[model samples]
Target: MARMPSAERRRQLTEAAIRAMTRDGVPRTTTRSIAAEAGVSLSVFHYCFDSKQELLESVMTTITEHYVAVVRDAIRPRATVRETIRAGLQAYWDHVAAHPGEHMLTYELTQYALRQPGFGHLARRQYELYAEIYEALIEQLAAGMELDPSVKVPVLARYLAAMTDGLTLNFLVAGDAGAAADILDVIADHVADLFRADT
Candidate 1:
């Protein structure tokens, strides 16, 4: 295969590691398997990442950025807060449906990081990242609508992050897009009511 730039090679290795972990689970994943998946040699993997943990950390960052971008792209400046909520939530669900394997791998990696030595911080950082993204989105939505939220942005951000995580886990296990859609409607309504400016 033709050689790739260092940045491209690093991204390839990170993506390959995600696929490898998803296919084989964290316990069975190895640098050899990740390199094979990336169509590169073990030495290339070592050149790209000093250790498996480092690779996993990069994978987490990559996935987080991808997920955030999906949601951000889905959101639009709607005339109504309810419409905005619905669009954002639907976009998120669509992303989940489109990339189930990657989402599953992300959850698995979270558990793996939590249980591994010197890696629990990664899991915490993951949630913090989510919260930050959610907070920013919420702020943007509020600004777009010229409204102020009843609750603080940080609290709302954490609540939405936790709610989305639970909703996603349920949808994944049940494979019930209909039920998830209904739940999203409820969430949208709540968000609309909670974030609307005082009458």
Candidate 2:
């Protein structure tokens, strides 16, 4: 294989780990398997990740970034705040609808982390990343649209994160696309109502 920077090699292995974990539950995915998936030697995998915990954290962060990029692009100041919010939510929902397996793997990772000794912090970090992403998105939207929210940004961010997390899991379990879309609409309207454009 051609030589690559350490960061590039780590990203390659992380993506491979995501594929492996998503296919074979997190508990089942081993560093050897991730190495094989990435077409790299086990030594290289070890060189990149000190432990499974580090790899899992990287995988969770990458998975979140996948959909976050989509939502960020979709939220770019629409004609109205409601339209922008709905676009962002729809973008995220579309990702869940399309990649159910990947999203399911996120929940599995959470459970796997929580149950594993010395790995509980991974689960907390995963949720923290979710809230942090929402907080950044909220700030971005507020700044772009000159809107002030009734609720503080940090609180609203956590609320939105929790709401979106639950809603995604509900759709994953129930498999109701129509109902999910309706709920997204309601959420968009409710969220839009919470913000007022600066006069």
Q: Which ten contiguous residues of candidate 2 have the minimum total lDDT?
A: 143-152
TM-score of each: 0.92, 0.96
What stretches of model 2 exceed 4 Å from their correct place?
A: 144-150
Residue-wise C-alpha lDDT for candidate 2, range 1-199, written one tens digit per residue: 8999999999999999888988998878888899999999999999998988888899999999999999999988888889999999999999998899899999999999999999999999999999999989998888645545357878888988988899999988999989988988998998888877776
> How far off is residue 76 in model 2, in Å?
1.1
Go through the candidates in order and give each one's C-alpha lDDT: 0.84, 0.90
- Shift in Å, residue 46, candidate 1: 0.9
lDDT per residue for candidate 1 within 2-29, as digits (tens), equals 8899889999998888888878888898
